[model samples]
Each structure stands twice: as C-alpha cells, then as structure tokens.
Target: MEVLLAVDVRNELRRIGWISLQPNGSVSVGLNDRTFVSPDFKAKNFVWNAYNRVTIQYLISSDPKALKPIKNPHLTFHPPIKFQLRANGQHMLFEGIADLNIMLQQDGRVPWIRFVSKPVSELSKAGPSWNPDRTKILSIRLGNEDCSIGLGVDFVRKDVDVPTEDLLLSEFIDWQDYKLYVHSVAIPAQIATLSWYHQK
Candidate 1:
C-alpha cells in the first residue's frame, strides 16, 4: 500500500518562525527554536520552496513472515500512525492514520482493504531560501506495522554542481529480523516540485 502525507506549514510556521531570504541572498531558517544562517542560495531555495509544499510518500506492506491467516480478527481495529517534523525542535505538522476499510469479497472467503486520506493542497507561502549546511528531520511511527517507526532527514549540499549529485543520500533499517526497509531518501528539487504541483 502507498501512503501520502503532508506537512501543515502554516501551523509549523506558527510553532517555529518562518524562514526568510535575506536581502543579501543569505538564508535564515528556524529549526527547533534556534535560527541557522547560511550563504548557499540553491540549498536555501530548495528547502524554502519545498518546505510545506512537499508531500511525503511511504510505501507500506505486510510482514511476509507474519502474514499467516488468522482464525479471528477485529474488524474495526484500525491502527494509528503518527509523524513529527523537527528542525531544531518539534514542528507538529501532521499526526494521524490513513482511513482504512475492510470488506469481504463475494466469494466470502477473501477480504479487501482500502486506505484513503483527504486531499491536500499544494500552496506555497512566502519564505526564505533553505541553507544547505543545515538538516531537517522527520520521524514517523507506523503504530501497528512490524517496523514500528522510522526517521528521515533532509540534507542539502552545494559543493557539487551537478543536479544529479545534489540529492545524494539513502538509508535502510532492519525491523525485528522480519524486514529490511528503505527508510529514507534525500528529496531532489525536480521531484519535490513535481510532488508539490501534483497535490490539489
């Protein structure tokens, strides 16, 4: 299953001050409660433009080893999934689980599960560019999944001029010896912009 989630930037800005692009082309980003300053325009622009406008996508699946049929299961037991966005402190952007519904097939021997979420808007408010030297952290808790939780970080770099090398980071996590999951990938500007435009 695929889960799409968004960060509420308006609320996040309220909790943490807004990022700003200085007149001198410098960037000021508020993480936690402290401000970080940087001289990289591309990095700042990438984060500033993408911040709240970007939506996160997660690919979810059942643990292969734990997929045995159950004799009896609770039909209404939907699990809660929580996520946190933090720069320096906590930016409570989103917290909730996908709406899940289960139905029995006509054969009465099979079941189907459907997950849904309300549409999210793709609007960008005013903000400064992002600083490539700083990093932003996002953590997710998949409450009932075998892999209970995971962490993702947005790191910016300007040392490399090639666009392909701009977003270069990947990580994996192992859960209970049951799954080896790709935890995170650095977001590229092209992908981020596409994601923002895709949101309605």
Candidate 2:
C-alpha cells in the first residue's frame, strides 16, 4: 500500500524537508536528525530546499531505514503532527496539538528516548496517573514485526477528551518520564525486536 501524508503547516508546527512519514501500523513520521534539524541539529529546524516538502510514498511493508534520505539526522522529539493519511483509497485525519513526545535517538546513542508528559518532578511527588485526554494517540509500536519503522502512523481511538493510542511501551516506567521502548523504529519483528533485545 502506498500512503500519502499531507499536513497543514500554517496551523501547526513547521515541517521540514527530511521530515517524512511511511504509513504503516506504526509511527509514520521521520525527522531529519542533523541535516534538516540544523545548521545546528538541536536548537533550530533549519531545513533546505532539497527536502521533500509534500510528496511522500509509504509502502506498508518496506523497511523504514531502507528508505533513502529519511534515515539520518534523527531528531530528539516527535510531537503528534496533525496530518491526513490516505491509503487504500481511505483518508484518515489526525487532529490535535501534541504534548506527548518520543525522542528519536541515534541508533546507538542510548537505546531509548524519553516518553514524557508532565514534568518528572510533579509525577514523582504525586505518583503516576493515566489521563484519557493524555492517552497517546499515535500508533507507534516500539518493536517490529516484519514491518517498516521510521515515523509511521497507526493510531487507535480510546474514548476520552482525546483519543488514547497504543504506544506498545514496556521495560521501564517513570510516569512523567516514561523510559523509552525505542528511539528508532522498523516494522518487521526481525529488525526492531532483534535490535531491542540484542543491542539493548
């Protein structure tokens, strides 16, 4: 399946070149870690004209890393990007300003990124609580299942003020600072899961 991702840059966060997405049952968005993220990879999102502004083709079964150009300069944060994904002649719209984020780490930077909501300080003192309004609505599976990774989209709607998504998280729980399942992604069980167990 070839999926097309289109977003409203005016109403949301600025979109960059390498910031691409492959629509599978996972996180379908990609951030341009170094090249696009910077001039300075951490502070500003300085992308160039070489970036693919609006044309994206995502095969549900392709390797996220296998896709050229989209696999480098990984960013540290993935906020819920509002977009309309079309696949199989179906259009899916995701609307919300995101406060939930997943930091994408270098393949070997630290094995995981921070999954945070409120400040770590607040959650520690008050204990952790799950909110429906805050149920992450991005279908970002941490491990792969013979599928592609990268920033792909697979969301489920849990009832609440906002919809809850399946983060497919495990291993550690810090509440406000939920330990990461993965900073990078792939769809196949071989690619992501193997890396998760072997490298981690």
- Judged by lDDT against the true structure, how good is candidate 1? 0.21
Point to the candidate with the largest lDDT: 2
RMSD (Å) per prediction: 22.7, 19.1
The prediction achieving the highest TM-score against the true structure is 1
After the best TM-score superposition of candidate 2, give how far the Cα of residue 121 lies from its true spot, in angstroms: 42
lDDT of 2 by residue, 85-114 (tens): 222222221122112331112121122221
Question: Each model's TM-score?
Answer: 0.19, 0.18
The digit string of per-residue lDDT tens for model 1 on 56-80 reads 3422222223332111111111121
TM-score of 1: 0.19
Write down the lDDT of every candidate, Cα atoms only: 0.21, 0.23
